[model samples]
Target: MTVLGHASFFAGRPVVEVPASGPLPAVDGPVAWRIDYPDWDNRTDETPSPGFRDRFDRFVDQTGESVQALVVGAWGYAAFNPAPIDQLCAAAPRLPNLTALFLGDIVSEECEISWMRVGDVSRLLVAYPRLESLRVRGGENFRFSPVRHGRLSRLEVESGGLRPEFVRAVLDSELPALTDLELWLGDPTYGGDTTVDDLAPLLAGQRFPALRRLGLCNAQIADDLAEALAAAPVVRRLETLDLSLGTLTDRGALALAGGQPLTHLTMLDLSHHYVTDEVVATVQATLAGVAVNLSDPQTPYIEGDEVYRYTVVSE
Candidate 1:
């Protein structure tokens, strides 16, 4: 369940990583293109590695016209690499058919979640008006501006620590067509400084009128968040609600179980939690019809009087 593995599929198409520098193979149906920075150590020549723009240009020349989805992985040294957001935005015209894009798809082996540096893709959203989905990984030095895209149905972000600014930008954004939204609000120690107030707009249910799936997972403040969502207006409209991968305890679970009825939801994912069996049973009974996932229950470290609970992905 860790987010360490590379994506096998995207935008309803199979993933195919484009060669670092070779003729792209033909005779394939629609597939998601994964453009990666060539591993520096693997290169035989002493020549410098190609920047993301060069690889992207090559991708554009080969199958840009036919490609419907694109994933950018390992732009350079994962610790300091900032994605070429401007260049990608400028070259949007070459890939008119692109309906989806994922940035910072590097795995943990290259760089841990908290160490990656990624930039904003709001410009790309503006450039690709037809894009239906967008996904991003990493959090360090990540930037995003509020944007509106008519066709965007899904927007997802994964980070070891998500900042408040990103949350504010997304909540302030007007995504009339967005149906799915997931943001991993990682631990504050890693740089996730987002507070529940920053998520006020989303909980208010004024933005993203079409949103049906809402996931505010991987937060250190899961209890407080559960308290907020216990009475949030957005919960009533959502078909899927994910509060997993966090340090949720019985306090939070009891609040949810005693709060508003979640009968309207079709799926409720509370996996990777610190709740006990009693609370788990209560939640299951409450949302009996929903596909509730209570897997990977965690135990807090109890030393003397203090207790410590951690989210599944804190790195």
Candidate 2:
């Protein structure tokens, strides 16, 4: 499903947006502190209600070492800096216990997915050595370096068009504890430059042996991906395979149905697709034991001799 609101839960903790210049809530258990200017849609750089930096400072002042999870929301409407890479990296020492983080959690109202510009997120990994889960949203000006992270287990990047270099960097890195890897390979019209060939290392199971959930979703070349993934070495060991929010047709579904036996899987999400009802039955019959999400079957847009298929989250 499309992300319409703020994250309800993140990193196994319930999300609570804490205000600036306010008393800290009585945190009995772990909670993900989501920092952002209130009514941020109407907010501007001139507003007296604190900017992201001020809010972050307040949060750190109130609860520094105890903070376990954090989500960085809209930085500013017209403020000096947009991305919080510098502030976040600079304040890493103040947030020692952070294990889960979500950067650029701004919704479509604040900024479109393709309009966001994120810098080298590998710095976050380096800054938070004990981080277990990290999620980033955006694609434009996004970057990554092939850095080994030992304790990182879950990594999710929600993008309109993810860069091939970034994808390659992720696949090349060494994450001995990585279990969940979900990437949204969005529309090419919005700079989705990644190809199926770039995913070879992951499909071959060359890295991240502990990876059990693999989601190469929101792709334009889903049929090609399905063809390659049919016999990929990685699928055998995966418990969850999410090919959702893509342009997967009956042809791709048939390939998956006729390919390897995926009876071992616990969940298979193929939602928001264009597969026919007959093929849908075939897929359901093929992987009956698995919890397959075949919702929102789309009918391709037709104009004369041309047919157009689209992914779910492309803006």
Candidate 3:
């Protein structure tokens, strides 16, 4: 198992890492397969190494249809290339067992999160009908036309800022088995135009009947989100709520404490916020026994003219 640490560019936050266990055995169960850059040192170049395509082909050949949960990292300057999903789709027949796919596992050194240009992933979803979980990082030029898939249980899009159209596509799509949904509603400067109104369908509990976990994170307007979530019907039904890695402040924490009955939730993640220790303690006390994470409080500062507090990860 190779543990890869995903250290936050933002200060004070913990370095979260995922263990990559690879060279999977041909078994009839979930197996994690990692596809990394052929040459890590020269990843900034536009073209991939001659061996890169061969390596993926080799992986498909060796895995022999018993592979699931593929993690793709650094496809040699992915920002400049078409989405790697296209390539995976071409090899879909060989990876009949694949269910979970984590794309863009590239770190800051390989490509800045905001700089990673992703293309339409609709074809990839269509290619693999059995895909249950899809986690994608990077959002510039990202798109997904309305799609319907019965097996998808989790969909996580981690972008510096996600496009509103992508959010709309998810809302309009048919995902009957979707239980977990995480969207990083990043800074507006990076194309994140989704407002509280855009999330009205999800917040009203009118969509995704199986959704138990909801993450509206990495937001610039965390305070407004908190206020909206307090009154959202979906909050009452959720088992886990994540409002992390954003600019959540004391006002937001107060709204959560005073407005909502979050005791029903098993976990509430409000990590990487601008809220004070006192407010965090109060909120934790209010939601007693509800496994709350309020780490990495940001210290507000004054930039040239206006005071500023940033989301955890943005270019």
Candidate 4:
């Protein structure tokens, strides 16, 4: 069953029931509410709006079942410069039912000067120790600490550059239940000089034991870096791998598919980048068992920027 917000156009009415006799797709178990609000970046006042938060809290209060996940836009008033973002994340631990958090536009210029404030979100992340999947967008201010949370299964890092300390934190946490992992470079500051070698030690070995789905988007992947992933055990169980965007050339492509354990991959997205059709074909032939998508013109590749997410999704 889907819960409609009182302010929603579909609110104040029961969800339409389907006939038992008719065929219907099974609902993906666990439902969540998505709350979107305005932002200052769009040329609004700098302060966040209160109306949005009021509506958001109302939706949560009316929600009956344990919310499997929550897709939230902004925390305070404006989605752009929300002041209460930390407050909402802090509430995550209280929502025992919440497991997954999908955040959007988390990093904006408003918090650029003091990225440390976003650390509040990190504290809330620890609250949901049983969280299964996590995706962060916008800025890279939030630090991933080594707080032990055994139930976390999947982790996706988008945009923002992660700190070296966070890598050790992840390893020390001992995420025994983790299965899928994704890392995309956003707003690259180092250019061609940036190598995965800097990131290897963080995720190389026993760190991500159960990782499966690996998506590397809009990052600079050098040949040696790609080879490093091939050598890592993290690539063994990957079922879906996406390496799209950025300045990845044929060298990186070959290194990734030359001889690796990414045989079970079912979906692959390689959009943008300078890798030619020949390189793609070579990777395909190398991993004949995996289904691959070379490119999607509609989604133009981003060079070095990151995407910030703040919405919650249902399980």
TM-scores across all candidates? 0.93, 0.93, 0.87, 0.69
**Candidate 2 pairs with clashing backbones:** none
RMSD of 4: 9.2
Predicted model with the maximum lDDT: 2
lDDT of each: 0.84, 0.85, 0.79, 0.52
Single out the weakest 10-residue window by summed lDDT for candidate 3: 9-18
Per-residue lDDT of candidate 4, residues 1-315 (tens digit)? 011132121111222212223232244453444554534445345444565556655555555345666665444323235344555655665567777766543334223312212342445456677577665543424456666667777776544444445544555666677776666553334111235655664436556666666665555543445667667665666677666654456777777776566676687666555567787788888878877766632223455696332101100
Indicate the TM-score of model 3: 0.87
- Residue runs of model 3 more than 4 Å from their true location after superposition: 1-30, 38-51
Q: After superposition, how far is residue 247 of candidate 2 from its true place, in Å?
A: 1.1
Across residues 1-315, which tens digit of lDDT does each residue of candidate 3 receive?
Answer: 011344232111222222223453444333466676524454445444445566677777766676666777777666655356657888998989888777777777667777776778766789999998888888667888999999999988888878789898989999999999999988888888888988999999999999999999999988999999999999988999999999999999999999969999999999999998899889989999899999877898887889888887766
Task: Answer with 1 or 4, whichever has the higher TM-score.
Answer: 1
Q: Tell me the tens digit of each residue's lDDT in model 2 across 1-315.
A: 245688889988898878666697776688999887534454334433346678778789888898899998776642323567778888999999999999978777766777665778888999999999999987567888988889999999988888889899988888999999999998888788899899998999898999999999999888989988899999999999999999999989999989998899999999999999999999999989999999999999999999999998788
TM-score for candidate 1, residues paired by index: 0.93
